[model samples]
Target chain A: MLKKERQALIIKQINLHNKVLSSDLSLTLNVSEDTVRRDLHELAQENKIIKVHGGALSKSYNVTSQQSDTYAYEEKNIIALKTISLIKEGMTILTSGGTTMRAIARALPSNLKATFITMSPLIALELIEHPNLEVILLGGKLSNDSKISVGGEVVNRINEIKADLCILGINGLDFDGITDSDWEIVQVKKAIINASRVVIASTISEKLNSALRLKVCNLKEVDYLITELPSDSPTLLAFKEKVNHIL
Target chain B: MLKKERQALIIKQINLHNKVLSSDLSLTLNVSEDTVRRDLHELAQENKIIKVHGGALSKSYNVTSQQSDTYAYEEKNIIALKTISLIKEGMTILTSGGTTMRAIARALPSNLKATFITMSPLIALELIEHPNLEVILLGGKLSNDSKISVGGEVVNRINEIKADLCILGINGLDFDGITDSDWEIVQVKKAIINASRVVIASTISEKLNSALRLKVCNLKEVDYLITELPSDSPTLLAFKEKVNHIL
Candidate 1:
């Protein structure tokens, strides 16, 4: 089989069985253990799976398949509250689409007079109820899974706007930058980075060391990284040392 | 063959031949001339073909299988101009996804100050260049075919917002109300209607008297219906008598 096909099969196997050993993958694909480990590492970088001492595990399977509404509601709500606290009236902000961003949208004070620009349909609906806020939607090819805009057209649009702040949701983050598994999403995130003056990323602790196939930006691109955990947490500290700020 | 399928086949033949007499199609499809004329008339109602003297000719063959970006451009532009004229500085507007609405977005003046809420990625991008406008996008299931947001989540979000104006794109407009071909789209339109104080519909003359599978709202639901043709046109007169203001 082609390498792409083999890698697809490996991902499928891991998805089905919840884990896969190097030995099993090597034998199944007629490759060496070293090769299998390399494949596992690549997939790990994509944040598609977690590489353990022996094998790989699914990365927060609960949120991977369901809508953002089904994911960690409490943690997302907390992060959202914290993110919204940074906003002042009459500011322009850019945001991505996800449960986390949706939470932040819901958390916005109804009386705040900020102008919000985003690619999430859910956020647009939320902003309409807020009489004081103005909402702008970015247009592009819509992803069936994320229900957000992601494509060349969206990227082009993002280049035209300059926002005071950008609230981002990361699937994974590390010394390298915020990462996502989908290629099209990577393009969208890049656009978000270019449009915003200050970049604030919200992610959980487990995603610290993880990487994904698409790199949205490097550590320098983000001005602040927000998490539900305290600043003293080991993982949070580790991430802070690699990046600029931890909130 | 089923009636719809047979009609589709007759339409295809007419498209291929450019013009087909009733007797000609009746011979080819092995149907009576009466049935042939009926099929032609039905397709004509959909604006899929145009009946001529003693025969029928295909509507401009520009509409391909893939999505056509060319639907009602001049008319849509006029409607867009009228729609954008309704927006005052600092007003919040709700918009649905379609080529017509996208045109309205493109027509927005750079100096115009407002907040735009929509489910279309393209509209969001267009609004970005207007420094005075804010954009908000609604998140939901994305339909690849239309490149727009749809589904229950989008509907729920629309329920949460109340906007000053709602600009809608229509597949067809009959005496009963605005109509769409897709059931999910109709659902989203319903939500948009409930969330906005005033509803303005931008449709072309061809959409008059046409009915799709999904119904959006009754004629009273929309405050203004804008079309390309003159208000004195026979079709427009017929429509105005049944509906509200026709622009």
Candidate 2:
């Protein structure tokens, strides 16, 4: 099994029993004890679990809980909160998978009706709780870390879809260009941008001046920028000239 | 034995008996006491269980807050359990949308690698949890009650592929024929039956000798009929004569 698959199962087991032994996980996942231990260690680093001696215990809330349990960072929460206002009822959306996008999924009202097309399996699960919403999960080879779909199949599927807006997550952004580290992610993001009428980049201000190896798009391509900082913040002045709207 | 398997056993033992010794595990799993001790130590770190003097304590292990709301009817559970034997590791199965099919989706092993074609959006979400399972959701106009897809698009999609088995959930069944209440449902069920080699009808024994307004298929066409009652029961004898197999 893939590492992401193993990790997802581990998270599921921990949430159910609230505690899991490394030995038990090894047995259930049909993996080596050492691999289970490494998974526990990584989850611990992500603040999703606390590594104990014989087994691991889940964090305060289940990892699967939509909004409250995960994405508690101050700035990400601020960006997530502001992005909700941009999405109106009955709009079709294309969302890339990331922590910030997850926040938006959690904050969505249960009664709201909308169509959401996403490549991330984890994000699809998070958004599946909305009773009135329609969730379309694009299938392809699953990426281990980002937990999103990548490769040619995903791009082909996205090409056939056109949405009202695309909510994108970025690795870094600057006057030079918006960038992401992973090549496959850059490809998928580019398709998402093309499939939607408008592109909204969801990010914190800390990523403003940094640049990654791959250029995703130019600054002028972004229709709206949602951030925690006020629209009039001096830090956003340079961003304003390149984007149509900043919130 | 893998360390994770050993650790899982230890946790299970503790849950069942309230405590377990490291020496006992080493003897049972053919591992060293030091390894068992290390496992216990790690589980303790996560607060999943308490590393006691010789073994471990339950340590909030019984708190099953993470459990999804399932396991409602004993009859449904029995049918779901029996259906597992029919599925192979890599077989593609077409699952009809309903409560009983959801149970089968929930019971699928995490390691089982198979393609599941489901028309229900809700079942798609449930089956998506299995890491190795490839879910092909047949999207079309949604039915409010069953939450499965209906109409021309769904029929067109199912016509293009053949599956090893089709797990059908019925509203009613009788010696005369299998039936459903909705016209669209009957149409979809007919297409699903045509798209698979094997047809397995899952129902409570109470639904026997009952007929709804619309006909799905004849009793002679059913490959398997699964219910809560024993196969030898006179209640199922009539069904046995028509179906290819029963359990």
Candidate 3:
């Protein structure tokens, strides 16, 4: 077998079983144990796997895949399903990156057709998985901490596209306004809100009424508020008075 | 433990073994078999693993990690090493996306400081792993097949930067000049060539003398031609005559 194919298979094996004996990999791949050890060593160097005395262990998966089991996974899933009700066919959508937004992307119907624009390469990759979605990735200096595109270049690109709706995954939301920790992301979010006709801010209930250092937009600018909580719940009563819709 | 943490641990365990018995997981995690089974089911639904009658297996590893084992793996490693020799600390580098460039990124010295720019998100992510490197991702319409940003936006961004070197992984090269099949990528490469002071074309020796449908640049435009073959080898004789440096 080709080395690439063999190593790929070995990775699959390790991921599936959580551990793999070098002897077994050699037996399965029909390569010498020396070759298997060498493959493990290379994979280890890549940070893809951990090499032990007799076998290898998979590196813990990254956050993208780990999103499914993230904190408040159930709540996020609820918001994801609820947010889907607001999206319609043939809409141009702008999105911010977060686990909550990813949940909404995952819950999207396979047949839904839309154009998705985002500064997050990871989110762009996820959005493209939907067959009917056209994904445009806005590029600029990639923030090492946020993994999202930033700078005046990205903001300029956002101004060129008049999106039908904007789905913002915000860090903080309160009667004062939407807020976030990073200044660059806040700038990008400000552009997204202005480029779209309507804005929907999605956050977990725990984040409601919370504020951060950098302000994004006023609570009045957000046309819709989405959370896992029931629309009629007392927790949302104050927000419901400010936003057009709460779900 | 949080379900996210538990599931992440479960994923790590499954990745290590390539297959894990449900009963074994229950004992190791100190959870009921039912909980283990539920965890396995949720992971399966996410397409993270394959559920079998008795256990689960991992999806094969992706192309980035598999680059080490890719076609002409050894040859690419040689090219990668040679390419590193051309790099000096504190230079601004522009790179095209491919296994060869990734190999070079992997081989970079830990202490080297450089600003790397690219239209590939995958490359940007890989480049950021190097502590001293600043990664700029040029964004535009992401081509589904190539996974590289294309369109006027990316080209405009390239025009704004004066890079010290452009390391391109090309599809074809001949006495006729550099050729590729994709027009969008060709456009991006043309901009890369115009923006950089020096251009290094790296490819496996086997790709030499080949031609694709679209043209990228003339043979003389490339300052350096890098192949796995030794510079004095008979195969490089023709290319050595046109390019200033053959490595």
Candidate 4:
């Protein structure tokens, strides 16, 4: 099996049982114990799972096989709640793909009337319960790891869309600006950023001040910043100087 | 709690524990047993769960709380397996959304290289693990129950997309035509039929000949038909004259 598939299977197993034994995963996946351990270690590094001796436990209380989220999924969930409060009825939103974004999708009020133009298929599914919410999936080439449509088609499609607000999930954000590890995703983010009136970048405080391969935009380009941290915290204070708003 | 929210919670609880009692759900949700029983009854009507006296069991084995798809989920799964065999690597496919399509999405080979243009947000999530597959979600108004896109945007998008093949999930298919209960979905499927080089329809044999609200297209419009029934069985032989291909 491919490494991605194996990791996904491991995460699914953890979500189903809330914990997994390395030996069991090795047997079920038909892979080496060392491979299972390595996968566990990598997931731990991503903060997606808690590494335990001989096994791993889910990072959150109840993972629904959605690969949960990053570094304190519950904390990000709180931030997601705040993000939804910013949404006014009948507004158009441009949402980028990630676990944090999916949380926002989950927390959206079912009765709220809104239009969401999103690049993430996963976020679209998360938002499916809303009867009044209109979802426009920005179509294009798909990126393997990120699971978002990327590249030229997405960029071109975004050019034709103008949403009231844009909520982006970032890998890294620093003084240098918002950066992503993949160029294709960075291009698509640029389009999403360009198409919206208000662009808010959301992530856990743990990811702040980090830089990656390609820059999506400068901090000045981001209208607002959101994290689990208090808005007035020193962590956000640095970002407040670079951006117009923080939440 | 809203009826939808109540239903979602019941589904989640059922997924967490293989079975859940109505009394326990009434206690947990702070609703009356009557309300809980009503919710359970509604879900059971949607074919979402197996309703037993006093409680409910999961509709299928190991439902991941992604609303595990359709009546006779296992029977649809058999047809889904055969659908995958028709797909060639690197083909661009136009797919209509439903439980059967989701089963096909789940059964897809991880190594297969293909692009799927679909209207279902749920199906997109189901297809996310295929590293080589490109998923383009047709966006528009979200239908409350079906969870697929509809209206002008999806119709217009389909017009521009000429896929190599189109696979449609139907409410009913008989000599009259492939039918659906939703007018908006029928409009979108009409556009899909116009844009595809080859059009195929799949359903469980139990749903055959049960026509609903709208007529999507004539049986002559379908290039292939797939059912759980044996191709040479007396049951499937009825559809042989109308559809060119069967599996």
Q: What is the TM-score of chain A in candidate 1?
A: 0.70
- Model 3 residue runs over 4 Å out of place are A1-74, A130-132, B1-75, B106-110, B230-234
Q: What's model 4's overall lDDT?
A: 0.81
Cα lDDT for residue A105, candidate 4: 90
| Residue runs of model 4 more than 4 Å from their true location after superposition | A1-65, B1-70
Candidate 3, CAPRI quality class derived from DockQ: incorrect
Residue-wise C-alpha lDDT for candidate 1, range B16-60, written one tens digit per residue: 866677777778778888888888877765556766556676664
Instruction: Give me the candidate number with maximum lDDT.
Output: 3
lDDT tens readout by residue for model 2, B1-247: 3355456677778778887888897898788899889989977764557888988888645656643434346777888888887899889898887777888888887899998887775677677767688777665545545556678877887898799999999889998879999999898999999999999998878888999999999988889998888899999987777888888
The local lDDT score (0 to 100) that residue A242 gets in candidate 4 is 85
User: lDDT by residue for model 2 over A7-41, one digit each (tens)?
Assistant: 99899998897789888888988988999998897
Please write out the lDDT profile of model 4 over residues B79-119, one tens digit for every residue.
88888888999999999888888888988988999999888
lDDT of 3: 0.85
For model 1, the superposed segments whose C-alpha errors exceed 4 Å read: A1-247, B1-25, B32-67, B232-234
Across A101-145, the per-residue lDDT of candidate 4 in tens digits comes to 887898888889988888777787677667678777665555656
- Candidate 3 has a DockQ of 0.20
Better of 2 and 4 by lDDT: 4
